[model samples]
Target: MKLNFLTLTPKATVIGLIMGLLIVFLGRGLGLFFFFMMLWFLVLSAIVSFIGKKYKLKRKLFEDTRGIKNVIANGLWPFLLVLAYYFLSSNQFLKYALIFAFIGSVAAITADKFGSEIGVLDGEPIMLLTLKRVKKGTSGAVTWLGISAGILAAFLQSLVMLPWIGYFGSAGISMLWLFVAAILGGLAGTLFDSILGYFEENGKGNKYTSNFFASVFGSIIALTIFLLLF
Candidate 1:
């Protein structure tokens, strides 16, 4: 099956172009590191769009924001994380490369899915903050489905990280910090996205604040786990 993301605006194209350049310049995995990511984004975008059409999955999140806004808000943190690893870490970049990409991409997609699906399933009005009944689609309104979605979102991302950075066999513990980092980082990132939704529900001025904070929180949580556990 083939899907074209031509529906994506020129701005999104520009964002891809710029990210492509960054991957080429700042990304450390290898010459193909950025190229592969570029292709991944293209393929994923197509897949998501195709699935969206078949399933009527609202492309709202990716669409609501401007292309540049979407990229910066959604893509920048993960990009930075990869760039940091490339420059700072001595480990083979490919070893953890897919892990990084998985956490970032899956977290965003899952968060959206959880939020939308759970909201639709639960007929009760929801308080995005507490998940107690308030109003359907109300910002901060959470539901059982939403929480479940959050867990799924976090888990899938963790899975992407786990295969390469595996857990201990005898002890059933993580042998590497990246595994720990990716799990905590993904959960934090998912929650952060939800928190942003809450702000919209509450009429907070700055919506992007949550994304910025979430990325920072995810990074800190990942690094903290890496340091304390490993």
Candidate 2:
């Protein structure tokens, strides 16, 4: 899919670039390996966004003007995790948890985005709670295609971080943990997003609010799992 950079609002574009640059710089300052990992993460996210736009997904957050807000909202958790990593790098006990948390956060957002964008293309979707057939793109509606896509997206997101796992000298064990954390976080985040979307669609809250909570919940779930295992 061709992504038209011109289609992005100037303000959003500027903000995204600034954020991207800052992340890269910070990541590099931490380590070259981390720099590449962060770059991979951003590149993958861009590709996903491109796919969503190419397919004409009805998600409002992907729109040019509103897309800026979506970027900031979704990027916040990962950004904070990176900052935490930087500050706590010297702390042996917390560094791995922070790294996994960051990975989990990205996985969650990636899965949710893929599921929502791809799921809506299915001919029919059923509400998660009711299991009744609902219109595609309807809040809380899910389809097999979307769920599969979500699972794949989460796995891919975690896979990209394998280098980080290798860097720590526990490739085999860390890989399994990262995969479990990412998949669980992704599924939980997507479900949380759907639940929040259901309320938002019913006039209980705005999309941004629901999305923010979903992101937070997704990250938390991943971090909790990491802590539990380690």
Candidate 3:
């Protein structure tokens, strides 16, 4: 199904502003960095959401606006990590890990959004697990277009967030290690989302939960890798 999103409803806007405030306030030293990165993610995701907009509208698969749930789903994990950073940042190791974890969540959401929105424009899709042909907007579906877009978004997200993350700092993590944690976490998280979509198609889950779990999963992946290397 084609769902359109870009505009945030008034309530969503209010909640989003609250979340932004939390990021800015809770981040303390990293406040500006989180604020700027969050804004950057918003603009990037919004642009991707606009792809095939005219076409999607005509096709009746677009919903035209996003609600508070959408905002919460997309922003919750990142926001929680920011909150965690406020409390746990005294530990140098956890601080850097939290930064990479934050990157993973943002990257995953951005990647998934890019994959779905851009993929819908490409052509028909096939289910990720079954490889059976499916509609272009079919949940759990895969398209080369979507895959490429997801990878690109993940890479770009990780690349841009590095400055905010401060290139591993005194935590002793290598830049390459951070990149591996982030980019791979994003890709894995997108795949996890599509797999969850399989359950969604069968009515076992919903989009909000899927998005939330996907972010958490991405964060875990990055954190796990970082810990492993540490």
Candidate 4:
């Protein structure tokens, strides 16, 4: 049988393996200190993508050249930011930052999954910001179901970091922080994503730059909130 990796573009598969090795094993250490979240991220992405495609919830926001261009344009900053955080940070903060950064990235990507899948399948429209009625899949549009799903996806991602970031007994509180961070961050990122969708027509390049910055801002915001509350 053909290998699963063969199904992915070389760039995608290479980056995936490199990211996994670098983040989980080398950067964070292994066994007890392993950053297993990276593996979960990969598995979750595949599952979400497959399920999303099966549901026919794919948004044509980026089509053909548009999709490749958008992914490349928007992804660079997050990629570099994570790399810098891993390489440049002291051991103490590096672990925390990486946790926050991974959570942010997961929330950002999977927000699209929740928003698209829930919105497309739902009967009533939900507002992106206010939770009121709006057009399905409209830019800046959101639904209650979608937001809940986003929170679910984000929380799962956040939970994977517990061993690396918090104490065993504190897992309950950590769960609280993870839930709150993922839900709020995922919502904020989704809203931001919608805003990008709306504005890509006028200045896609500018939107690309802003996307990274916004994600950083969202990550910081989530981390800060978690710290303050817990």
Candidate 5:
């Protein structure tokens, strides 16, 4: 996540901008705010993946340079929620809730990335549900280190919303509850991703599919919490 110009594939760059533009069309305020956040997200994600570069490379765990499909897989849910804000009832409650949902969506993926990038190096993984010792990269397997990393990553992502707390607080969004939703929503999404790894193991889906739905789950969980509180 160096601030330097990371070599984005031409197609990925095009797709990213197109998604960003569409988001702007849906909500200019949100669109503008997210543009910078998206950049920061990208930088952090890449750096997280690069943390144990030589180790990951030796173990075949290194992340490849993400391309267009990667962008779409990660970007689609946030965009859909933005479209929901644009097309659905325009009440402040819903809009504000969706804001947390957007954060949750991004946080989920970030959790996954951080968890994997850091946790994989722990060298001891077990089945997610059974606790049976399993090899690294085994779908549905997890490590304590990974789980903690995921939670920490999600919390980190939630904190990004702190600066906006007062601005939204004026709009009836409880800064405390909203922050809780963001963190829990993110955690649920990461857990869901791990659960879905079973389906991935059985060839029901791939990493992209899991990532996509985990993001959706994060939004759903965030929205639920918002509705309950507000």
Candidate 6:
């Protein structure tokens, strides 16, 4: 039987394996970690694959697969926050904050990714600041359809963390808060990304730097909301 591993580059496969092991070692155990990892991987793959086919583009989706830098810039903070959650597992308060932060970070990045991939396809993008129509794929450009898709994507990504609610012993009352934090965080992150993109386009910074800052900003926003509400 052909294996799905064949489709991944050697480096990507290695990184996935390492991340799996790290998650298992971080107190999630093999079984639970594997389940979470599989679900996360599959969902992201489906999104990327759909966009790739729709755009008939091979390079954009696969760019991160070949290098460690993009993965670190876009994803490392969330993973570190996951590790922080485990480290603070003994402290219910801090653990809860970290958990929300982690989920928010992931949701933000997912929303941003969805916005970028799907948004570009919508014709006649408008600059977020000036409301002027810009070239398609122009930095800081947005559309109504794209923003709608991003909000929906954020909601879906938050739902993915539902299985952890029970595991973390979060009260049912807090469910709405989690979803709100995630959606808001996602929107905040995407806005940060667009702002940074505007600067990047004006020759202020590079894509990687903007993404890193956006992810960090999202995490902070999530943590802030959790602290305020609970």
lDDT of every model, 2 decimals: 0.51, 0.69, 0.81, 0.54, 0.76, 0.67
State candidate 1's TM-score: 0.63
User: Model 6 clash pairs?
Assistant: none
Ranking by lDDT: 3, 5, 2, 6, 4, 1
Q: Candidate 4: list runs displaced more than 4 Å.
A: 1-7, 30-35, 52-81, 91-98, 124-139, 162-175, 201-214, 226-230
Best by lDDT: 3
What shift in Å separates residue 216 of candidate 5 from its native position after superposition?
A: 0.8
Best by TM-score: 5
Q: How close is every model to the real structure, measured as TM-score?
A: 0.63, 0.81, 0.90, 0.66, 0.90, 0.81
- Cα error, residue 144 of model 3, in Å, equals 1.2
Q: Report RMSD (Å) for each prediction in the order shown.
A: 5.9, 3.8, 3.4, 5.0, 2.6, 3.8
Prediction 1 global C-alpha lDDT: 0.51
Q: Candidate 4 overall Cα lDDT vs. reference?
A: 0.54
Comparing 1 and 3 on TM-score, the stronger one: 3
> What are the per-residue Cα lDDT tens digits for candidate 1 across 41-108?
34443433333342234424233223556556556766766576566556644324433443444354
Question: Model 6: per-residue lDDT, tens digit, 179-224?
Answer: 8888888788877888888877799887777767777777788889
The runs of at least 3 residues in candidate 6 whose Cα sits more than 4 Å from the true structure, single-residue gaps closed, are: 1-8, 27-42, 52-66, 168-173
Model 3, span 49-69: residue lDDT tens? 777889988876665578899
Error of 5 at 99 (Å): 1.6
> Clashing residue pairs, candidate 2?
none
Off by over 4 Å in 5: 1-7
Q: Where does candidate 3 have its weakest 10-residue lDDT segment?
A: 164-173
